[model samples]
Target: MKKTFSREGVDLAYRDVGDGLPVIFQHGLGGDEAQVADVFPDRPQTRRLTLECRGQGVSGYGPVERLSIATFAHDIEALADDLGLGAAVVGGISMGAALALRLAVHRPSRVRALVLARPAWVSEAAPANMKPYAVVGDLLMRHSPEKARRLFDDSTIAAELARLAPDNLSSLQGFFNRPDPVLFGRLLVAIAGDGPGVSEAEIRTIAVPTLVIGHGQDLVHRLADAQVLAGLIPPARLCTITAKSQYRAAYRREFRACLSEFLETLA
Candidate 1:
């Protein structure tokens, strides 16, 4: 069932379903609880909980400048504390996965295992990979959403970027009609400014089970990041699939199936 929990002065939305081991999954940068509805299929033995993160859907954005991965990690920490679900299996996609990784490292006692799906960060902040987000946010701020959208769709800059990294173009498209353009732009700037959120030594200290899922055709969540994570985390296993930006049913289905299989192992 869907419920609201008050945390850090915001009423965060989350859903707690199923029966056994608590599995808390986070949403990606441009996603909320509903966007991640495809994850965590009906499982009788797992209590799947999905958090909407601050400022995503119903959750409040609070301060525009406080939208870093670290802040999101704290929100999860607060949610876990409020729910009294100690050391639950924590996982997420892209920004969410990076948040999970940061939480696991900074708040080790709160995470039982790690499910890092398409992680966006690495040992340090990856500025090169985050540049597209910053640029898109700047564009939105300077021009109308319609104009910004057209530029990314028809301009030479976006065309060149599309050839080299179509995923970046796709990401910009998603942010075009953001529910709150001003808030979204602010978030994009802050997120792009923030780096990978964890260090080699920090990730190396994780003793819990970890699963790293990566894909090609993704400039935001590069496959190299996943490979490196799998190699770095002592108990991590790597799984690769087609990038979600391709919008292929086969790729999405494969991801869901892989994630389901991993959840079962936990049970």
Candidate 2:
């Protein structure tokens, strides 16, 4: 069932389902709980909890000024505290992966295991890969939604992404079609420009078992970034899954298999 928890005056939404081996999984930018459900394996023995971050999904925007990865990480921390979970398997996709990594670094005691799926950032703020998102954000800020979509469709960025990263291109298109493009644009700009805030040295200090998933054909979440993360954490295991653009079915299957395999090892 869906639940709501207040954090810093914002009513954030969350889900606590199933009955054992609590796993705190999260969704990416412009994603909601349903997006997580699509890839998460269905198991009777595992309970999953996903908190919709501020300005995403059904969650309320709590102090819009505080939209960095650190803020989102703290929201997850607060969710864990509210649920009385001292430590659980923490993981996520894209921006969600960054949040999980941040928790593993700063709140190590609260992460039993780490699962980073399709990570987009490594150590620095505003990585080059995220430039497309910045472009979309700028368009939303500068022109009307219709005009922005028209402009983006005709831009070189769109042409390049259509040929190289169809999945990323599709996601960017969704931004133009959103009901609140302005708000989402601000969110995209803030988050795309923000990094995990945890340095490489700090990442090396993470002592828990970690699973980093990455694939090719994805410009936004590069496989190289995932490789770097896997190399940093001592117990991290790197897995390369099928790219979604190559085959959606295989991608989901491989994603679930990787997650299930890692979860079993933790058992």
Model 1 ranges off by over 4 Å: 154-157, 164-168, 245-247
TM-scores for all predictions: 0.92, 0.97
- Would you list the C-alpha lDDT of every candidate in the order shown? 0.80, 0.91
Q: For model 2, name the residue pairs that clash.
A: none
For residues 1-267, write the lDDT of model 2, one tens digit per residue. Answer: 789999888899999998889899999988999989999987768989999998889898766589879998999988888788878999999999999999998888899999999999988999999999989988887889999999999999999999999999999998887766777778889999999998999999999999999999999999999999999999999999999999999999999999999998887
For residue 152, give model 2's deviation from the true position in Å.
1.1
Model 2, C-alpha of 255: deviation from truth (Å)? 0.3
**Winning candidate number (TM-score):** 2
Error of 1 at 200 (Å): 0.8
Q: Could you tell me the lDDT of residue 140 within candidate 1?
A: 81
What are the clashing pairs of model 1? Answer: 125-195, 125-196
